[model samples]
Target chain A: MEFEYPIEGGDFTRAGMASSQVKKVLKQLNIAPAIIKRIAVAMYEAEVNVVAHAFKGTMLVNIMPDKVFIKFIDEGPGIHDIDLAMQEGFSTATESVRQMGFGAGMGLPNIKKNVDELQISSVVNKGTTVELTTYIS
Target chain B: MKLTEVVNKLELEVICGEDLLENTVTGGYCSDLLSDVMGNAQEGQVWLTIQVHNNIIAVASLKELSAILLVKGLKPGKETIETAIQQGIPILRTNETAFEIAGRLYNLIRQS
Candidate 1:
């Protein structure tokens, strides 16, 4: 199964809708609870990043019998330092975002932790793409 | 502790899923950070957060939480409530602060 969501940037409130739907779908599919939790966590982190950092973006989720794939593509001022951004406590979220209990710099790192494979590419002036895959078996 | 007792002691309103009030909750976690909640919360726990976003419901569902308490008198938006309802997660609204709710729930569950 496959699903796609348009993540509206700066709309912090609606950030986790995609991940929520994904979790529901996986549960209905009878996926293992542990794998479902891992995917949900990774997807939620990436979804939050789209709202907190990007101008706007899309989250694509593709599921198969063996693995699930998630891709986040955003049109924003891309990450200047991917390494720094990947650190656990290196967020640039505004005060408002911080007040909502996010932007503690754990987004990308958490995504990385939960996924089996994580690939990220970015250009300073253009955009960024994050690909995350989790094996079902 | 049963969710009903938490509701009674905390003086919270059941915004949705009143039928779930009798469900038992094993522990309580209070945090507005989605990632932290995702990482820390165990199954059957009650999540006490001041955040009213849709993702909060998502995290609770992912964690298999018994219910979610929106503290500090925060009212969730229509979309948030609808999503929680669809997920079958009971959401309660409380006039108490997150700290107060956490403390009271701790005492209540500890005694029980």
Candidate 2:
């Protein structure tokens, strides 16, 4: 199965909508609770990253019998240093974004810990794309 | 332990989701950072935090948390309470800080 959800930048109010939808779909598919929890955490962090940093983004999810795949493509000020951004305590979020209890510099690292495979690519002035895959087994 | 029991024991105010007072409380997690809770809090756990925002509800729901316990006399916004009601996860409040409440909650659960 496949699904797509739009992500709005700087929209803290709706940051987790896509992840919520994915959780529901996973539940309907009888995915194990443990796996679903991991996916929910990873997806939510990625979604919030878009809302906190990107101009706009889209989440593409594909569910298969043995694995689930997700791609988050965001158009905005792309990350200049992927390695630095991946560090647990590195973030370039604005003050307003951090005030809401987000932008703790843990989002991307948390996503990495939960997902089986993660790929991140970005261009200086264009955008960033994150691909995450998790084996369902 | 039932959420109602915790409410009564801790003297927590039920801000919303009164209908879910019967939910079970398996454990407690105290954290102000959203990602920490998202990455560490387990299902059925009661989250204790000073942050009062609608996203708290989102994290609680996504993690299948039993309820949210607002610490240090913090009150949630109108939208936050409404989301808690809609999601059926109780929003609870307390005058104590996370450290105080977490300790008490730990003893309560441990004794049970």
Candidate 3:
């Protein structure tokens, strides 16, 4: 099954709705508890990233019997250095984002840790696309 | 400890999942930072925070947390409540600050 969510930027209040929905579906599917937890965490972090940095975006989630694939595509300022962004303590979030208990630079790293495979691609001015896959077994 | 006891001791309001008050809580963790909570919280632990967002519920579900307590009387928005109800995660709202709640819960758990 595939699910899609349109994320609105600057709406910190509504962020993570998509990830919560996905987590619910996975639980009802009777997926392994551990895998479901990992997917939920990874997806939530990505959702927050979209809301914090992107102008707006869509989160695409594809669920299968063996694995789940998540894609976060945003039309926002792209990352200047993927390596730095991937570092555990690097972030460009404004003070406002930090005040809401996010933008700690652990977003990307947490997503990467939870997923079996992660691919991040960005153009400095165009946008960013993050693809993550987690195995179900 | 039973969730009801925690609610009564902390003087909390049941925002959602009242039926779940009978559920047992093994321990607790308090943090407003989502990243820190996501990294540290364990299963069946009660999460105490001032954050009122959908991601809070997501993190609780990820950790299989027993419940969430919103401190300082912070009420989550409608969407947050709805999502918590749908996820079967109980949320309690309290006028007590995070520090007080954490201290009380810690003592409670230690005593039990």
Residue B23 alpha-carbon offset, candidate 1, angstroms: 3.1
lDDT of 1 by residue, A1-137 (tens): 88898999988657787788788899999999988888888888888888988899999989988999999999998999999999988998898888778888888888888999999999886889999999997
lDDT tens digits, residue span B1-112, model 1: 7888888877889999888888888999988887788877888899989888776777788778999989888999898899899888999988878888899889888888
For each candidate, the alpha-carbon lDDT, in order, equals: 0.87, 0.93, 0.87
Complex DockQ per candidate? 0.61, 0.85, 0.53
Docking quality of model 1: it rates as medium
lDDT of 2 by residue, A1-137 (tens): 99999999988888897899899999999999899999999999999999999999999999999999999999999999999999998999998888888989999999999999999999977999999999998
- Could you tell me how far off, in angstroms, the CA of residue A95 lies in candidate 3 after the best superposition? 1.6
| Fnat for each model | 0.69, 0.79, 0.52
Model 2 misplaced regions, further than 4 Å: none
- What's the CA error at residue B53 for candidate 3, in Å? 4.9
lDDT of 1 at B13: 94
Tell me which of candidates 1 and 3 scores higher on lDDT: 3
Over the stretch B76-108, how does candidate 3's per-residue lDDT look in tens digits? 988889979987899998787888888888998
The residue pairs found clashing in candidate 3 are: none
Number of clashes in every candidate structure? 0, 0, 0
- Compare the candidates by DockQ and give the number of the best one: 2
Name the weakest run of 10 consecutive residues (lDDT summed) in model 2 chain A: A94-103
